[model samples]
Target: MVNETPQVMTIAGTDSSGGAGMTADLNTFAAHGIYGANVVVSITAQNTQGVRQVQMITPDMVMAQLKAVADDLAIRAVKTGMLGDADTVHTVAKALQQFDFGPLILDPVMVAKGGAQLLSDAAVEAVRTALMPLATLITPNIPEAEVLTGMTIQTPDEIMAAADKLHAFGTQNILIKGGHGDAPVVMDYVRLTSGDHFWMKTTRFDTQRTHGTGDTISAAITAQLGLGLDLKSAIIAGKAYVDATIRDGILVGHGYGPLNHLAVVTAQNQPEVYDDI
Candidate 1:
């Protein structure tokens, strides 16, 4: 019998703690019953407490990894996490342009949950200029969205405005995650290229185990997309999946713990979707 599993790729860094980065992305793909592939862009020695030291992979090696994966695996969807610097970002962008590695889910992973900056200022510009246009979907947290759009996002209107600014960057879809806000309920705003948008609201669990929430969600979306789900459906499923992971918390490390990737999201954890702005 031929191997028939849907394959997805994650181009990101390594988190030694197994909480965030490529680890989380791969775990998410497995949980969603999808085959996972990776292109290591950076390596970090860290745990749930915090990131200690980081070593970025060379651009040539990054390109080599991309070619190796694209040459073999039938990658249906791909997502990017921490690209480290401007050079790596440009390299990844060029690779995406070169290969038909399926839809690109660009996760603008700027800072670690423990307050460590994962992306450089020059890298931010590189992503905005080079990667954004190639992204099928861009997932950015509130802080990341603010940084990318250069606007202070404090209200729902501001979030939509930021999404518009991000959409102008040429991405077909934008998901502005509201997890950084101090609200009882987290509202993630989505803007599609077809002039359709909505807000996905879920109860904010009072826990600190959101270490890999962003990666987990984006990976879930990629998995669904690889499985042939439409973009809107993939986004909705991703929100539900992450909500389950967060709600079913697991105790691993001291500081911000990692999400329970094994937790199965039931229909009860479905996010309340708002079709209006």
Candidate 2:
């Protein structure tokens, strides 16, 4: 038998701060004992403070990086985050079709914590039409879900309704993060294509260290998929990892600080953040 280490790829942007984007993805993949590959779609001059500047890599270069990784690596799963523009989003959509990476987790990173625009308004439509159909799972935060469904989400019923709208867009699974909610306990909603849904709730952590939380969670899910976990298990495991990660936060910058990627997590070490709802 061959020595097999699951290979995972992240197609997204880079954070100069090394807290989010490609840096965080590689870190998460490594933490799961998986081989990590990357295709940089953009680069940002960002730190714990915030994103100061952004430069989108050309679509051709993005495709080239994907080609290099696809040709040599046996990528078992892949996740996308922070595609800077409409062209980059479409470019990734095409590559996902051309390549056979196992599971596709699309994190619709639209805006930064410090009011920086990561994805343009036009790019949002591109992601919906082009990327959604190709994704195995689409993980969007509350605000993003609002934009995608063209409606407001104030209640849990509305959250599930938004998931319905997202489901019609073509992904088999939908996870709308509730971190932006005003509730004392944060709840993340997940829905399968068959209309089945699950809720994972954890008391909100009062902190400003959630910079790369989105990318980190999606990365963990992708790595878990590469390791042969089912979709539901992968998502819940991702939540557990993120919950532990946020709980172990450290001060890396003045603004939205980075998550504690160094936090070693196991099924046992995972906090009792799960709630029945």
Candidate 3:
């Protein structure tokens, strides 16, 4: 029998810019040879400069879209992006709860790279309390992690602590991204439910084309999981894929541009994937 290609789903918003959200998730899924299905929860009148306006889809519509996909696709893994509000968040969690979509990789998208609030303030708690517990892996950058744990993350040790708190939030895995800070190296902390944890570091590239980094990485992880990789392997591979994307930055719109997802990179071109254990 021939091996079947894995199918993945991205439940997120839309970026007209084609740099982030569903666009980037689908791009990353394609790059990994995984079929991608999407459920658009919001639409932003946005480009590289910034998000000018956001119109969230209704909860019923979002659920309907989800139902349409689940009714047909054999979605092996899933990732969640920008759920617009508390109600939408609840709706997504409720619907997703009714099915087994394999591993749940959650990207708690709060603010955009241009400093626009993609998620409402009230929904922060909703995401943490309502949906986060259902996650197999939660990918949160520095600010999002701080908001979730209500703790400051300056020291590397604090990053570990934040991962602990997020793990307590009920996810079996946690990837606390440190790319938001200005440091010589981008440090990412990963902790699994089995008490296994490690810090991965790569030389940070200073550039404006890092707009869709979070979506890309989380989608990569989900795709890998769909293809049968374990959580640790998926996380490591996700970081490597994101590092390549960021390193090969491309010029898109005026402001912070999008990553060159089509950049040609073999395993030889990527950096050392993990740091001291």
Candidate 4:
């Protein structure tokens, strides 16, 4: 037997600006020391500015890519981002059932960072009915949580309620992110079926570089899962990584900026005298 890097696969859309979608997923996986494999589900004409258009990949193409990857790789963890429509969502769910893969981290990507509709209204049901149940953990930001759970989240308690509601949908765990607020402290609520709940609170970074943060967080958790970390630990690690990335993020373009996936570069480059040989 030979030692090989852990593999993580992402099924998501393509972000033309390279700040999100499959691009962000690959970067996050590489940063976490995992091999990233992906199947593009849609294409978005987007950037830090906004989304101008979207073109979804055909169901046949999605299925082919998934089959090609599943047949060839020992995928330790999987994450999903954007599914353009109900048919695509159904197709992805069907493929997952056929493959019988586990430990899926779902991002529930309905809209873009700049407020663009990525998924159609008709697809939400398909996602909830098909994909949500298959997820080991579903990571939903406040707005997405609102849509999925049909409750207006106004406070921390409401966030917990939203998590509970989402749990009723068959997902094993829920991470309701409260990062979209005017408050200084961002709160994230995680609920497990075992009656364990974690409230992770962090100081809000004072910046507009929120672009792709959700994708990064989802990918980070998936990578940790791929490396055999427990679900809670993976969530914690992923949250820390996302927070730090936001803290050290770059201000790019005229609109919302991007996360600093290269934050670990300096640490990786630090001298190891014995290893210099």
Candidate 5:
């Protein structure tokens, strides 16, 4: 008997909107044809519009969930997002360090779409000290890159500078998403600590349905890695998936909006116009 499918895990918060967090992560993995495992860190009271409130899960519960999944299933790859606070990040990092499981993807989720604080200033240090070193890759938007690097990223050159600063934190690869900048095209730059670089460019979709795009991108990358794609290839594929999802946006919420999670699976066999990638 052949299992034929890779398994990936997402350690993230829960979005009640069914758009972001674990829900989106699992859906993205499914879209990428991977079995998804998940560990919920926080329960967010959010809808299509924005995050209303967040309920932080205890560190002990997080540890228990990670241990339970790792002890049972062979997680081929893992992605971490929205760890709530410093303690939660440390706990997850400690468990990962203790068990030493699969390849890890870290999405530095510092703020929500509505400009809400998702990670604390104190916890940012914890993420750098504890988790960033163990990550196979770190996906950070421009704001997140600024937070992590303490440098303003206004141009593509500055984006490279930010990536270099993040590399010093021990992350193997840094995917700095340039969607937040003033560029007409969304250029996501992938730089490896080993001096390898890949740039993926897609015309920016002028839509507000970017709420869960980051989570979806990181999740898709993890799933692709689980399916044995190299880091650069996975990121390239992930960006394509995200761009497609945004293109297929349904405009669900009144505020920020949600992505089209099913677009990938539905369009998998369809022709690639290069728009969907």
Candidate 6:
């Protein structure tokens, strides 16, 4: 007898409040019916209000966790989030290069929703130099995109320019998320390695429970990839999953609350897709 369930891994920090980071990633993976594995890089004492204290795991320990997971479970896809510092980033990147983890989804988590910096400035540079080249898909919000591309991203054209700059870093695909923008509709842009691009537009819900949105979406995509969906379809499905999770908000903490991962059980609002742009 053999197990055929899809298995996915999340390389990220832990949120004590269980609202974001590894917790959210596992929840999203479970919701998608995928087995979830994780390698903890840091720990944060945080809640919906803010991040209080952060303790980074040693690089050696991080490598041990990565090897332990890779040695046993047949991980089909992996996503990285909330890497604490430069050493940990380098360690994870090296381990990723050594292993055969199917698809690497880099979620370059920089600042927490509560104004806490999760990844150090030096680690950002490490990600650009090391992890970016290994990423199958890199998802960045406007601010992260600006930091990576060193350009102000205001208009759609600017987003395209930023994506081009990111693609030059060797990532096969890029998804510039528009959730941080002040628009009535959130337009997430996707640029594939084939030079095909598209925008996924969804109505911006006025809610404060979008804490783990980035992790959730990226985890959803990883799970889809583990289940053997094509990259484009997986991305579209991930967007839909996140849209439903945000639209159906859940009250958890005082400040930025967590998304309803179980919202997929209800109606899913599909994003309006615009391609060939």
Enumerate residue pairs that collide in model 2: none
Clashes of 1: 0
* Per-model TM values vs. the true structure: 0.98, 0.95, 0.95, 0.93, 0.93, 0.97
> What lDDT is obtained when candidate 2 is compared to the true structure?
0.88
Poorest stretch of ten by lDDT in candidate 2: 268-277
List model 2 lDDT by residue over 101-158, tens digit each: 8889999999898878888999999999999999999999999999888999988889
**Could you give candidate 6's per-residue lDDT for residues 107-203 as a string of tens digits?**
9999999888888889999999999999999999999999988999998999999999999988889999999956798999999998789999888
Give the CA lDDT, 0 to 100, for residue 186 in model 3. 81
RMSD to native, candidate 4:
6.6
Q: TM-score winner among the candidates?
A: 1
Q: Which stretches of candidate 5 lie over 4 Å from their true place?
A: 1-5, 265-277
User: What does candidate 1 score on TM?
Assistant: 0.98
Give per-residue CA lDDT, model 4, range 54-154, as digits (tens): 88889999999999988877888899998889999999999999884558999999888888888888899898899999999999999999999889989
* Clash count (model 6, backbone only): 0
- Better candidate number, 3 or 4, judged by TM-score: 3
lDDT of 1: 0.94
Q: List the residue pairs that clash in candidate 4.
A: none
Give the per-residue lDDT of model 3 (tens digit) for 13-95.
99999999999999999998889999999998999889999998999999998888888778899999988799999998998
lDDT string, candidate 1, 47-150, tens digits: 99999999999999999999998787889999999998999999999999999999999999999999999999999999999999999999999899989999
All models: lDDT?
A: 0.94, 0.88, 0.88, 0.85, 0.85, 0.92
Choose 4 or 6, whichever is better by TM-score.
6
